[model samples]
Target chain A: MSTIEKNVPGTRELADLVREQEEELAHLRARLAEWERTYDATPQRDALFSTSSGAEVRPLYTELDREGSDPGNDLSLPGEFPFTRGPYPTMYRTRLWTMRQFAGFATAEETNERYKYLLAHGQTGLSVAFDFPTLMGYDADHARSLGEVGVCGVAISSLDDMERLFVGIPLDQVSVSMTINGPAIILFCFYVAAAERQGISAEVLRGTVQNDILKEYQAQHAWVFPPEPALRCIIDMFEWCSENTPNYNPISISGYHIREAGSTAVQELAFTLRNGFEYVERGIARGLDVDSFAPRLSFFFDIHNDFFEEIAKLRAARRIWARRMRDVYGAKKPESWRLRTHAQTAGVSLTAQQAENNIVRVAYQAMAAALGGTQSLHTNSMDETLALPTEKAVRIALRTQQVLAFESGVTNTIDPLAGSYYVESLTDLLEREALDMFDEIDALGGVVPAIEQGWFQGEIAASAMRQQREIESGGRVVVGVNHFMEGSEKIEIDRLKIDESVERLQVARMAELRASRDSARVDQTLAALRHASSGAQNLVPAILDCARASCTLYEIRHAMEEVFGSYKEPVFF
Target chain B: MSESIRKIRVLVAKPGLDGHDRGAKVIAAAFRDAGFEVIYTGLHQTPEMIVSAAVQEDVDVVAMSVLSGAHLTLFPRVKALLDDAGADHVLLTGGGIISEDDMAALDEQGIGKLFGPGTPTTAAIDYIREWFSTHEAV
Candidate 1:
């Protein structure tokens, strides 16, 4: 037996024996000419070049091609340093990804029904989509929140709503992901309080809060304060999550919104990494050690329609993050190097026409995310094109994930698509492009300055415009769109219509909440909130205090705004 | 393509509480690259705010994108506001998950055409061009 193998034959010997006379490499030129004459016209094929993300495309790759590249440099084991394969060694084979489908509706009671429905339908995790009032740090009763109560998502103004939100769902078992940003600390506190009422200990609590305010200021535009205090609130959650709810993900450093903001794959990768770096810098500035809390730091990415490109982007993200944490940030712990991310199917690709078609789009996106190695996933429902997804739509979405996982045979192997020459080359290309962007951002001081100086915003605007021009000029073909003009496409679809009765019920509940709650405690809690805001203390404890005292979301935010102030966006065309 | 106007003044604004603005932002830049001045109001705007801004900006078109399923309530509110203010000249267009029948119904209310999702960025822009010319006299 040679050093290459104990008994089994090498790839070259096996390939020869298995195929034998079927081997066509020697007659490739002649076969190509005959095939071209038979099928296509062109025979010469050297004109292919780089795609937009800078991935070079050659004709083919063999076992020899794998030897010359740096494929020898071990990517560290799964769950080890620079976890390129996946964050955990066992991955979904041991425990499947948390089925964290997004849940939100009009009123607290209505949303609670949806949440219960998701739990009943085998959803392993919960993701709450708060309405604008909650996201903007305003209460339903606030003037700014007028006419906006529970429109896009569920409205939670006080602890009453939070209590009502998880009525029957056991808080201790199901891991929840709240998609709240601007006022994440307060929202997180509400969850803690709600779980406490449910007789659940904070130590046993498991969940994630999208405590990503930096991304809010940059792409999501859901900020309630200036950068400094907003960051303070974020740090408080990080510290609290570490000590209390240790299993919770404090901030899901998001590239999803940035991708949605019209950035190139490279820009999306670079900007998101820079945003994560800025968060780490913020935590370090707060006098916290990198290793102490970096383990719980997770990520959220948008899985776009570009199949291989999206897969390569996620692979490159893991490799870059692992390398950067170990080399640049001095993260010694293997957990700190692992980039565990949750992915959502691209909401941008869902078409309102033949709304059912979004099913296929979501299926492809989910597949891409799975191939890209996401730890968790949420697929947008087909009917999400119209309004909030109905139960039927959500179930179909969940089924799509099931089919990809159990039926498709894709999850049977570990990193099955790894070492593909084109994929590896693309991964390298994306990494290099992203590193170039990081270098540029580092030169400009960092993400916050880049944001304030209008550079980052300007880049998104420019990239978005370029893509739009290409699509508009007939260069890009969105099927069932501009290219293939067909008869009124059959839409056996029913749009989700929010019954007006839902609004009436919601307003009534708000009125009751206003009547039953003690006014004095709310006033005192809000006063404490204002006092805490004016000084150099974390807002989490105060926001928690306010949530406990029945202080509405608007009162808490307005109290802070009186001290911290709001943002007036820059005039950019 | 008609007259060499300064820029196709298009207000790519979102009305109501939908936080989904990626599509809106992408469309805005699409219009901007197609040589239009795009006014993108971030997220969470009232119909009154959108109408007032459209009037002050004197945009050639007011493109409202709503994903909250609040378009039925929101579109009528916007049309009412614009009508009362005598600003019907601004080509009022919308996009999101609104159905074709609903699109026809909303059109009867003077709210113009509805561009569904997956409708190419160029098609939206061309519709704006056709809309601006035919209704420019208003």
Candidate 2:
């Protein structure tokens, strides 16, 4: 045992030592006051510095911050038990964090070109952003999809589009992360089918599907099925991926959208982890071993403008998840306890005014993600607030991550801010706040129940309202927006515009595919999917069958909706 | 401003696959605070549903918000529905993520006074109040 642990100093002895330390601190304060008077100095701002979430930040930190606290076994080595510092031991030294840029717009062919461009420019992984129609599981030819086919992101309706998307890209080598939740399983099937066409085995594939459905109801509002059925679809992926594609993460429990929807960092952390725990519980209740599926589970977070607080949130996340996995869920494997995450810079923080300032903002937020020990990070482009980023803006955004990796010495140490008094204290404070929120959620009978009653939406709306009031009232300054006003100048940056012809071509292709494909086989596979969805059998293989039979995305989604029905969210303000 | 004056009844509808009602909800809350009787037809309302709601509620104004880039389809359809139903006097105005060119085309198509992201909520309130004052029903 170490000397400190062996000593176990009594309360009287500790009290005496603290008293002596206070005396010394008193003398040091007097000397500091004299020095300040000699210089006649004042700090830059008169107002107290606080975090974005309204946590008060002190001017200075000292050893006294941790005086009465004994961290005790919580402060273990990096890769050890609770993993508060990081998930891995040699964090960036072994392999740098993946610079995955989320880029997809216009058509699959166009997005394919962008993906190849990003890969050529040293991007380590691919993250896809699907267009609104595809996200809602609509084919390009659907009447509701008019004028929205390829506006926001790429449009992929069938396995043919998915095949074109990865035309030259090798499925075995690159890790792809798809940001779709509603029809995520259908998309995953398309990817698997596309890989099969390329002769890649399913077991060797690697990537993540952001199939977190509960957060859709709570925040993003991109859900297709009701919570109960949507969760069943997710558990289906968990069971299938555990056996078939061990390398791919079936679900990325996301707090990025939660924060983007106006939740504070604490709410984001609490609600996301609670969602993750709910998934684990569902998987366990489905008779799957926690250790088997838990290791492959991953997380995605939003690194907002609050630098230290964001880092603290990440640290607190790992600690809380680790403890809960081991203590609460009673998992045996170490990997089951480690909480790995991917982070993107906050999109809501990007302003339409003085867009170039967004570059500086993104860089700071990227550093915070790195310092927070993200396994992968996507830096938002400056033009995101106005429109989709042009190639130049994307290149600059990719370079930001490269600079942090190669030049900036932030990667030299693992969790460099781990022991700082402010960071540690903030980590503890955030953990306490998040736990309190978890208890409140539990009192409402857990995450799904809370979501049904609109409790989660209410909390997010309240926080969002508070934030908006602050910005409107000038209590919070948004640099060029609220202060430091500039006259309007014509924006010179080229924004990515999806051609109207792209939608026309996409609709034509979908029509041709529908006309040419074997309708009998499509009907057969879709019936199989509907049957499997209604019964207890896993739905993934049946979805894959539909993908193989050239059934379009909407066809497969409608098939399941036939059995499970669609969801209309309960409105909450 | 007499207490006996009728409140302006408005239908705030979200008519697309997009679930981003942050702006729509905020505007609805502000209109409520401004003493307007606001009927927020929540997410995924078809243009037909929106028109039927407008007729059913007898709302004076229909504020259609579409952030899903489907405004070209949805806004024109909503306007056509109001026209065919002879509720042309029911003002149809909306906004969100629509570009300058699209906004101009939509304005020419008889969708009135679309607002963007940063336009103050009070701008919407002011526009509705002014429209009600000028176009008192026959």
Candidate with the greatest DockQ versus the true structure = 2
Q: Cα lDDT for residue A340, model 1?
A: 88
What's the true lDDT of residue A101 in model 2?
A: 97
In candidate 2, position A286 carries an lDDT of 95
Candidate-wise lDDT, in order: 0.78, 0.89
Off by over 4 Å in 1: A1-56, A62-68, A72-74, A483-488, B1-10, B23-44, B58-60, B86-88, B121-138
Tell how far residue A139 is off in model 1, in angstroms: 2.1
Cα lDDT for residue A263, candidate 2: 91
Predicted candidate 2 versus true structure: per-residue lDDT over A339-428, tens digit per residue: 999999999898767778899999999999999999999999998876788999999999999999999999998989977989998998
Tens-place lDDT digits, model 2, residues B46-132: 889999999999999999877777788889999999989889989999877766677899889888988865556778889998889
Isolated chain A TM-score, each model: 0.90, 0.94
Q: lDDT per residue, candidate 1, A79-164, as tens digits?
A: 65556667888777787777789888778888888888888888889999988778887777666665567777888887888999
